[model samples]
Target: MYYLPKELFFPSVSLAHSSGIIALGGDLSPERLQLAYKSGIFPWFEDGEPITWWSPNPRMVLFLDELIVSKSMRNILNRNVLKVTFNQNFRDVISNCQEVKREGQNGTWITNDMIEAYCKLHELGIAKSVEVWQDEELVGGLYGVDLGHVFCGESMFSLVSNASKVAFIALVEKLRTENYKLLDCQVYNSHLESLGCREIDREEFIEILKVEKVDS
Candidate 1:
C-alpha cells in the first residue's frame, strides 16, 4: 500500500491496488482535494480510519446525453410536486446526507470532518448541492464537487419517496443543458445504472476528464 506525502501529489491511478485504494494518510485540504479530483482520485474512508485515496477501474459515469427518465419519473416531473434548486441550503443538504440511512450500511462515510472539508470546497465554488423542496420544507438533496466538466457525486438523501431521484434527474437535465461532458459517479451500482450511468475503463474515463475541461 502506498502512503501519501505531505505535499498534494498523488501517484498514478494505474498503481492503485485491485480494490482501487491507491494511497492512505492524506489530509483533506482544499488544495489536496482539488488536485485529487483533477487526477481522478478521491478520498473514501470511515471516521476512525486514515484517509484513503481511490481510483477504481471500470469507473461509473453518466454521459449527459444518455440520461434516462422513466415513465413514472416523467409523470412525477409533470406533476411539479417537487421544486429543485442549486446551491440553496448547501450546509443543510450535507448535514441531511450525513444522517440518512442506507441499505446494508451500518454507518455513514460522510464524517464531520468530511462535511467541513466539502463545505469549505463549496465556499470556494468547487462544490455544489441540489435541493428538493416540498411545501417549503427540505425533503431531499444531493451534494458533490463540481469539476467544471464533471460532477463527482458524493452523497444524497431523501425524506420522501423518489425525492433523491428527482434531485438527480434535475441535476442531470441541468448538466445536459449546460453542455457538461460527464458525471463521475466513481463506482457502479443498480441505482446509478437505472439513471443511465455505466461503467467505463479507467483509461477512457481519465481521457474524458482531460478533454472535457471548461475554461476557468
Candidate 2:
C-alpha cells in the first residue's frame, strides 16, 4: 500500500491493489482531486478514515451515445413534472447525497470534510452538479468532477422514485449535446448497469483519459 507524500503525486494505476486502492492519506485539495480524475483515479473512504485513492482494474463507465433510458423513464421525462438544472444548487445536492440513507450502508462516505472539499471544487468550476426539482423543491440530484471530456460521477440521491434517474438522464443528454466522450461511474452497481454503464479494463480507461487530455 502506498501512502501519499506532501507533494502532489500518485503512483501508477498499475500499482493499485486487487481491491483498487492505489494510495492512502492525502488531503482533498482541488488540485489533487483534479489530478486524480485526470489519471483515472478517485478518492473513496468513509468519514474518519484516511483518504483512500483507487483505480479499479475493470473501470465502469458510460459512453455518451450508449445511455439507456427505459420506456417508463421516458414517460417520466415526458411528463415534465421534474425540472432539471446544472450547477444550480451544488451545496444542497451534495448535502442531500450525504444525508440520504442507502440500503446496506450504515454511514455515508461523504463526510463533512469531503463536502467542504468538493464544495471548493464546485466554486472553481472543476466540480459540477445536476439538480432535479419537483414542484420547485429539490428532490433529487447528483454531483461529480468534470474533466472537459469526461464526467467523473461521485454520488447522487433521490427523495422520490426516479428523481435521481431524471437528473442522470438529463445530464447525459446535456453531455451528449456538448460532445462529451464518456461518463465515469468509477465502480459498478446494478443501478448503473441498468443505465448502460459497463466495465472496461483500466488500461483502456487510462488510454482514453490520455487522449482526452491531449485533445482538450
Candidate 3:
C-alpha cells in the first residue's frame, strides 16, 4: 500500500501486496517506466484508477531456448504468408492492442495516457514492437519494453487468426538469435503457457533481472 513520492523511485518488489501491487500513484514517465521494468515491476491499472505497480509472485516467463513452436505455428512461419517487422509501427501496434476486445473484459488497461507514455519510451528506443502485416495491412502485433537481456511484454492484439502468435514467435526467434536471457510475460495466461511460458518464483525472476542489468 505504499504511495510513490514525487522523486523517481520504487519500493522493493518484496514489498508488493498479495495482489502484486507494490505501490500506487506515479506518473508514467519514460524514466519511471524504464526503472520499473529493470526492477521487475510493471504498471497495470484501469482508467480512473491510481497507477498500480505489480510484481506478481509467480512470474510468467519464456526462456528463449524453451520456446515452443507448435506444428501449426511452424507451418505458418514456413509458409511466410505474413510479414513480421520490428519497431516498424509501434503506435499502430499498441493502439490495436488497446482497441482489441478481450473476453470477460469491458475496458482496456492500455489507456490513452499509457499509450502516449509508451510512445515516448518508443521514441527513446526503450519500447519495441513487433508488427504482423498481411499484404501491407496491419493485422496483429505485440509491444513491450526491451531491456538488453530481458523483454517485458505489455500486451498484444490480433485482427486475424494466429496473427499475434506470429508476432510473438518472430520476436522469440529474434531474441534467441540475439542470445537474450528470457522474455518476461509478466502474469500467467493459458495462451502464454501454450507457447512454453511458465511461472517461476518472483525472487528467481528478480535475481535474473539483477544479473541482466549488471551484464548489460
lDDT (10s digit) by residue, model 2, range 85-159: 999999999999999999999999999999999999999999999999999999999999998888999999999
Please, what is the TM-score per model? 0.97, 0.97, 0.97
Residue-level lDDT tens digits of model 3 in 112-198: 999999999999999999999999999999999999889999999999999999999999998888778899999999999999999
Instruction: Give the total clashing residue pairs for model 3.
Output: 0
* TM-score: model 2 vs. ground truth: 0.97
Q: Which residue pairs in model 3 clash with each other?
A: none
Clashing pairs in 1: none
Model 3 residue 22 distance off true place after TM-score fit, in angstroms? 0.5
lDDT of 3 at 194: 94
lDDT of 1 at 93: 99
Error of 2 at 172 (Å): 0.5
Q: What Cα-based lDDT does every candidate model obtain?
A: 0.93, 0.93, 0.93
Give the C-alpha miss distance for residue 135 in model 3, angstroms.
0.9
